[model samples]
Every structure is written in structure tokens, then in C-alpha cells.
Target: MSIVAIIEFDEAGVATGSRLGDAATPVLRVDDLGPTRGDGVFETASLVHGNVQALEAHLARFVQSAAMLELPRPDVEIWRDAVRAVAASLTSQGVTSGSIKFVLTRGVEGSGVPTGWVLGTASPDFTRERTDGIRVVLLDRGYRHDVPQTAPWLLAGAKTLSYAVNRAAQREAARRGADDVLFVSSDGYLLEGPTSSLLLRLGSRLVTPRVDLGILAGTTQADLFTWAESAGYATGYELLTPDDLESADAAWLVSSVRHVAPVRSVDGRHRAVDGELTGRLNAALDARTS
Candidate 1:
């Protein structure tokens, strides 16, 4: 429901059919405090064929993120059931495939209590691969947490809802005539793509930056790493530089939306795509999901 209806939760762990109203799923009570204040955290996960992929992993990050933001922890099982309920509603409404984004915010009192959240779905449409491939640009910006080492306490690993910064970085990348931006650390080590994980293939080694560099520990990258390690591709995570990226055998941006999209050109310089690694990684992903 795009409309945010009045939700009544009962003691038996049941949330009534949200009473219809003139509102959006994103709109909490205008009078309700949290929605207006932009205070809370959330997680988006892939829902396919009634199964939530990597759900445990997703919630782990969500909880950790919310805790860091000082948001109260809602009952995990209840939220899980709520998500299933919404997906079931969509199923009854005849939506078969796509992604679902779940957002849980701080309660109306502005206290840490969960005000409630909205679960929404998108078609997840993406353009087919262009043989010309994408061009990447390096922005001066790099992620630096107050505390390094990528510990959970700093919320460096949480999936927070504050994505405005990420969006702005994408705009900056586009302004520079690049398909994406690779965040470099203050010390000039590469971290990640704004909305994607940075991965490179050097012959047989699949190299990604260490999470300690203050990057979002991407689910897609983690899954791909698992396959790469098992298939003897020599998965590795190390600090890389702009020079390392520009001279890599091949590179791609990994995420839920694009899967594995190759970067053909960086700073207007063209590079060869790694068809073999892409095919192998894609095949592994398909096999796991299928």
C-alpha cells in the first residue's frame, strides 16, 4: 500500500490490515515524529519465489545499524513476519519477481522505539549490458569512519537509511561524464563504488578491498567471494589504489541491482573486459539462486 494506513498491532503478534488513508507507505503520520525527522535505519533484500535470500545476513546489518543510530530494536521475528505478510499481499496482487526494500524507523516519540516501517517493492529494471561498457571516474571523496578498522560499533557496517550522501556521489560521478564513482580513502586507497562493491580480476585472483577500509560489506560481493574461493579463483581483499584499479586486468561493480556490470573505461581511458571471469561468476550466482 503506497498509503500509510493506521496500523494496529495486537498482543497475539498480529498487525491488522492497515486502515486505508490518504498517505504514502513512506509517509508516517505527519503528526508522528520519526518519519518527519528522518530518524531510523532500514534494509532492502531480494525476495524471489517467496524466499528471502540472505535474510539473516541482511537483518544482522539492519539491527547493527539501527543500534548505532540509537534506534530501538524491534522484535526480529515480528518484523520478519511483517515483511512476509507484505510480500504475500503482493503475491496475491500478482507480482512475481523483483526486490523488496524494508525500512524500520524510530518510533513517533522520537525515542529509540521502532515507530514502525514501510516495506516496498520495485520491478528492479536494468539496461542490458552494453559492449561499450561503463566508464568510471574517481571522485576525491573516500569513506573515513571516525574509528577505522571497520568495527561494528562505528556503524560502518550497518545498512542505514541515510543514502542521500550516496546519491549525491552518483550525481557527482555523472557530472564528470563517468558511469560510476570509486570512493578513494583520504590516504588514496580505493574503497568501493558509491552504490556497488568494487571488484577486480587479475588473471585468476578476484581482489576486493578489505572492509576495514570503511566500505559497506556488500551482500553480492560476499556471495561472489564465496563462489570465487571455492572455485579456486583465489579471492582476496587488500587495499588498492587508483593506479591499481586503472591497471587491473578487468573491473566490475557488484550489487543487488546490477549483479556484475563491467567498467570498460575510466577517466576516458579504455580497458578490456574480463568475459571469462564474468561468465564464471554469473554462472555461479545463477546456480546458487536457481
Candidate 2:
């Protein structure tokens, strides 16, 4: 089952209130720019038990995305309330694991009002991917590593509603007999996964690609880094390449809902999987309360 909360915004685009409604009900106008031109931003947060993990991080990124699209700033307090309310409702229905996605759109064309809503749904079991691991292919993202700086107009790092390319990349991965994709810059620098962040274990150090490479700073990766640091693992961000990935002791694609999915192979080339460390990582992720 799914739940929805339609956020009511004032003329200034400040969230004034929200109403719980059936997820299947039609709420958006036919002319909404979100569906039409994909002119909007969104954030999906993991819901574990009754807690919304990395909520503040998600909200911060949400506002950042909206600013990138020049949409009105989201009122954090109201949006937080709506998200928690929906999360609580889903938990009440006995959902222990799920996801909550909140979105803000540039409303119907020329309406001068933005449409917003929060949708929550139970999560699918990903035990196999988290344990058995997945295969991935490195696909060129058609942008240079410095795209975020050179072409900010492309909204490289922002998590916007425009994701046709991302979906297409996943489909292309399937056609290639891979489970997922790791996008490389046209210039041959390691970037990130379509919907996830790249993490590599280089000896005792845990590293990820630099955020400057037009990748969404991973909320899940941030949380895991914190725990990893506490657990005596060193962490850092760097400009990486396929050679770096090839040399890593182990690697994963981390995200909000899926947590950590170990990459078992790259382009059908078998890679080592650190089962012990992967278990520890997922355990730490599942234990997050804030």
C-alpha cells in the first residue's frame, strides 16, 4: 500500500499545510510542469521502523535542487511535518521498511504556484542484492568530469525531476546483461551510479568520488562514513577513475532505500566481494535513527 500527502503552499510558495489523501487519487493538474517539462525537484528518504533516515540531509538537498531550478524555497518545517506524518501513517499500517519521496514542482504552466506532495510506500525486500551482490557496467555519462563547474546550467548535481536519461541508462544496463550502471565522465573519470553513490574500499580507507564531478552528494554515503569513522575506518572523497575502481578491495553503490549493494563484477569481469564488511556496513545503515 501507498500513502500521499498533498502539501498546500501559500502564494509565496511557503508550505502552509498538508492533507493526507489516497495515493491513487488524482491531485496534480494536467498542465503541471513537473509532468510536462519535468521542471521540479524531489528527494527520497529511507523509512526504517518509524524513523526517517537522513531527513535533514534530504531536505537540504531538496532545497538545493529547487534553488538550482529557480523554484521557490521549501519551508523546511512544514515539509518535515508532512514527511513525518506520512511516515507515521505508514508505520501504523505495520510497515517497518519503506521510502518517502517529497516533491516540489513548478506548478501548472504560468500559474505562479508550485505543486508539492509526499508519497510513502513500503520497500521491497532487497536481501539478495544486499547479500549476493550485483553486476555493473561502466557507461559514459556524456559529460566531462568538470561538468558541474563548466556547465552548471545542466543542473549536474541537482536531483531534479528530469530523469529520462537516468532511466534509459538503467534499461541499457539491462540490455547489456548487467544489474546496474556506474556512469563515467566522457573524459574517463569515475562518476556515480544513476540513482546511487559510488563507494570503494581502498585498503583501510573508504573513499568515494568527489562531489564536484556532478554527482549528488550521497546522504546514505555520508551516514555510512560517519559510522565507518567511528568504527576506525578512514574515509575521504577524491577524483577517481576506472583504474581506481579496479584496484579497490571492494566496492558498492549506496543509496537511501537500498543502503549498500556490493558490486560483484564490472563489465562481466569478476571482482571480489567483502561479505564481512558489507554485512557490517548494512547493519550500521539499518541502525540509523536520525
Candidate 3:
């Protein structure tokens, strides 16, 4: 059974209706650019204990993405109402822990308005990966790290819904018997996972790829860094390479719902698991979100 709720929205971002646990329900028009041309922006937020986590941050990013794509600015209040309505509806349907996805797309072919909605779905079980860690492989993203600065038209950092390439990379990783992929730039700078941000520990300081490297600024990474810093750990946003990851005491792929999953190996180069650090990081993340 599909444990997902699809909520449709009107121009004012009000919920028109909802279909629960039905994946075959037609939610978007065939002419919608989101499906036809992949012209849209989205955010997946963890909904814990009936509260949407980091909603404001996600909204801000969604608005920024809309502006970057030349789409109309989303009315936050309308979106707020729609999201709360959907969340409340899902809660009534017995969803205690799940994810809320916000989507805004260029509307039906020539409609001149954007299509928007919020979807609530049960979170995937990542217990084994989180507990045992994951094996990852590095793949070239086929672009330089500075491409975002050099060409704004590429829509870098926009969180657009054009994810075919990212999905394909993950599929290739699975084919190679790896759990996930870490995208590296043509110049060999480590970037990020398909749906996550990369972070590695260097002695007492934690380092992640620079935002200028054309990667999405991870909200989970930001939260972890803030908590970790106050708890007496230094952090850095610097260019990192595969060699740096191999040398780190530990590394993780951080995302909103998945929390933190340790990287057990990279390109089959095994590293010792720092279970203590992973536990502490997860503890900090839980404390903040809980």
C-alpha cells in the first residue's frame, strides 16, 4: 500500500482536496511543466510528533528557488495554511512520523500561474543503513566546482525538481554494489551525495564542501554544526578532496529525515567506524529536533 497523501492546491495555495494512500491518483495536469519539463522547486522536511521541522528554512529556500527560476514568489501565509491543513489531515490518518514535501512548479502549459502542493508520506526505514553505515562510491558530476559562480543559468543550489541525473547516479551506484554516491567535480573536489550533504571530521574540526562548490546548503548539516560548535567542536566550510575523506576520523551523509548515516567506506577503501562520534552526532541532532 502507498502510505502517501497527495494534497492538491489552488492558486491561493489552499488545499482543494486530498487523496490518501493512493499513488495512482492523478494530481497534476499532463501539461504541467513540472512533469513535462521538470520546471519546479521542492523541499522535503521531517514531520516529527506532528510538527514540521525546519519549515521556515525550507520555505525561505523554496522562495529563493522560485526567484532564481523566474517564477512568481510564493505567498508564505497561504503555504503555511496548506501545510498545516495537510499535516493535520495526515495526523488524523495515523501518521505519527513522516515527511512533508513542498512543491511549486510552473503551472499547466500556458496557465501563467504556478502549481503548488504539500505531500505527507511515511518516512522510509533506514535503520540498517544508519546503524551499520553505508558503502559509497565517488562519481564525477561533470562540472567544475565554480560553475555556480561562473554560470548562474545552470540553476545550481536551486533545489529544482529536475532530478533525473541524480537518480541515475544513485542507480549506477546500486549497480556497482555501493549504497550511495558522492559526486566529485571534474577537478576532483568532493561535492555531496545524491540527496545529502557531505561532512568529514578533521581532528577536532569538522569540514564540509564549500557552498560555492554548487551544492545545496544542507539544513541538517547547519543544525548539526551549530549544536556541535556550542558543544566544543570547530567547523569549517572548505574545499575537500577524496583523499581528505579517506583521512578523516569519520564522515557522514546528512539530510533532513535521514538524520546522519556514517560512511563505512568510500570507493571500497574501508575505514574504521567511529561509533562514538556517530552516536554523539546523532544525539545532538535528536536533541535539537526533539
- TM-scores, all candidates, are 0.81, 0.99, 0.91
Candidate 3 regions with alpha-carbon error over 4 angstroms: 1-25
How should the candidates be ordered by TM-score, best one leading? 2, 3, 1
Off by over 4 Å in 1: 1-27, 31-37, 91-96, 109-112, 127-132, 142-155
Query: Candidates' lDDT values, in order?
Result: 0.67, 0.95, 0.82
TM-score of 2: 0.99
Residue-by-residue lDDT tens digits, candidate 1, 55-97: 6766777777767776655466656666666656655656654
Clashes of 1: 3
**lDDT per residue as tens, model 3, 76-172:** 7767666666677677777766788888898886777677677777788877877789999999999999999898899988899999999999999
CA displacement after TM-score superposition, residue 215 of candidate 2 (Å): 0.7
* 128-181: candidate 2 lDDT, tens digit per residue: 999999999999999899987888999999999999999999999999999999
Off by over 4 Å in 2: none
Error of 3 at 103 (Å): 0.6
Question: Highest TM-score among the candidates is held by which one?
Answer: 2
lDDT of 2: 0.95
Better of 1 and 2 by TM-score: 2
Better of 1 and 3 by TM-score: 3
